[model samples]
Target: MSVFETGQTVVRRDVHRSGRVWSEQALRVVADTSEVLVAACVHGAEARWPALYAKARDDGDRSVRTEAFEAMAAGEWELAAAVWQETDLLLWKPPATWFSVNAFFVPEGDGRRLRNWYVNFEHPAHRTEAGFDTFDLTVDLVVTPDLTRWEWKDEDDYAHVRRLGIVSDTEPGPWTPPATRCWR
Candidate 1:
């Protein structure tokens, strides 16, 4: 029998990026069977600097490491320094049909945990035999975990992409409220 059933609420005990069960979090099973298990609201932390450095050194994406190295060479050590120490927890919900939400938890030093929450609104995930994939929608909402303050991130980039016909303006209004409620 399959471990999970369709429409069942379960916790993901695996890392989405690495496909290793490093931790677990409550999620709703959108589709589950012997072949594959697709879920929503799975959350986990990603090692920031190490992954970036590795990607830059090994993977095709060199921008992250390049920026860090350039910053370090220019004597702007702070920019590159934090990229090595800080981690980010991503609260992700793979959409059933409409859109997906990714809320990032950034770390703050000095014994204060009042870090930033970066919410990315994106397209609904496409699950394949290998895994899942999703594209960024350009615009994003940035808010604290407490929701006391909020703003928009990458408006210019979003507009540019829209102008290029890469993505359309779709409201991610439905996802945020529940996330805020759950975090509180």
Candidate 2:
């Protein structure tokens, strides 16, 4: 098992089961241990995403985003260069876990403050030379910074992906929501 040093630049790749990359983002290693890898990216970090996905972000059209998923389902898409915008991101990934916890920070008066906590249910991390790889299952949980208010994100999309055979019924095991977990 290889370990990444703190402050090292690593590329996180979202790979499809067919061995194609869906997206790639650069992150700086925050912490690395046998249990998990922690990484962070500030606004302006480099990223490459499916063109349709980038369109969805720029247009704010839900239908366009849905179209992106459709593209993914067909395994036909193009990558567009993009930059992480407006938020600082901290990602925590446990190699064998089926999910990852993410924290997004937005600028406040002089510094930044936690905007929200996001939990992405996905395949476990696979170590790579650049950084790591994982497949996003499309479903996620978004929690308020205080962890008081939370909601499921992209459930309809999850269903759509499942119907398109992007995710298998047995891919994820029984899991608990963040609300039910002990954060403190």
Candidate 3:
């Protein structure tokens, strides 16, 4: 009878925790895109590093913790640091490299409507912070469409989205992401 199936499931907590979920998606995109786009992505996702850095600073790995502290202390953001001030979450001073976010939004009729958006983030892989060489990315999606766009005033990658707000821009744009049928 179906090899004695148990009608139950087993889940690994680590899969969702430890940044594995977001990290894996980030890595896959890094592999699929051209070299030029990668840099652009880093630019787009710069705003979220504050939260990530905070998370990294408290990392369980002794080496990672050390690296996080050093990164946060240097305070060298190439872009504006205003958002971090608003969020009140700081982790690293300045990182050698960084990654940014790209979110998908569906368009509405009249070419004007609100849509949900998400942000992705990543810190470069460094020996002190887990000993690797790649983008450690994470994605942050808005739960609702009314969510207004926010960022460190001068540090935005998109002139349109920053001014119109994510939903406003997303509604009347080339992007027309299809509805998800299932979780990837």
- lDDT of model number 3: 0.28
Residue pairs with colliding backbones in model 2 are none
The residue-by-residue lDDT of candidate 1 on 141-178, one tens digit each, is: 76776778877765655555456544544534333222
User: Candidate 1, which segments miss by more than 4 Å at Cα?
Assistant: 1-85, 97-99, 107-114, 169-184
Residue pairs with colliding backbones in model 1 are none
Pick the winner on TM-score between candidates 1 and 3. Answer: 1
Q: Compared to the true structure, candidate 1 yields what TM-score?
A: 0.43
- Model 3, range 1-184, lDDT digits (tens) per residue? 0111122211101121123221211111222111222211211232323334445444544444334323333432221221212111111212343533333333345443334333333343332221133332222233344445432211222332234332233222222233332222
What is the lDDT for 163 in model 1? Answer: 60
Ranking by lDDT: 2, 1, 3
Clash count, candidate 3: 8
User: Candidate 2 — which residues are off by over 4 angstroms?
Assistant: 175-184
Better of 2 and 3 by lDDT: 2
Tell me the RMSD of model 1 versus the true structure: 11.6
lDDT of 2 at 55: 94
**Local distance difference test, each candidate:** 0.45, 0.89, 0.28
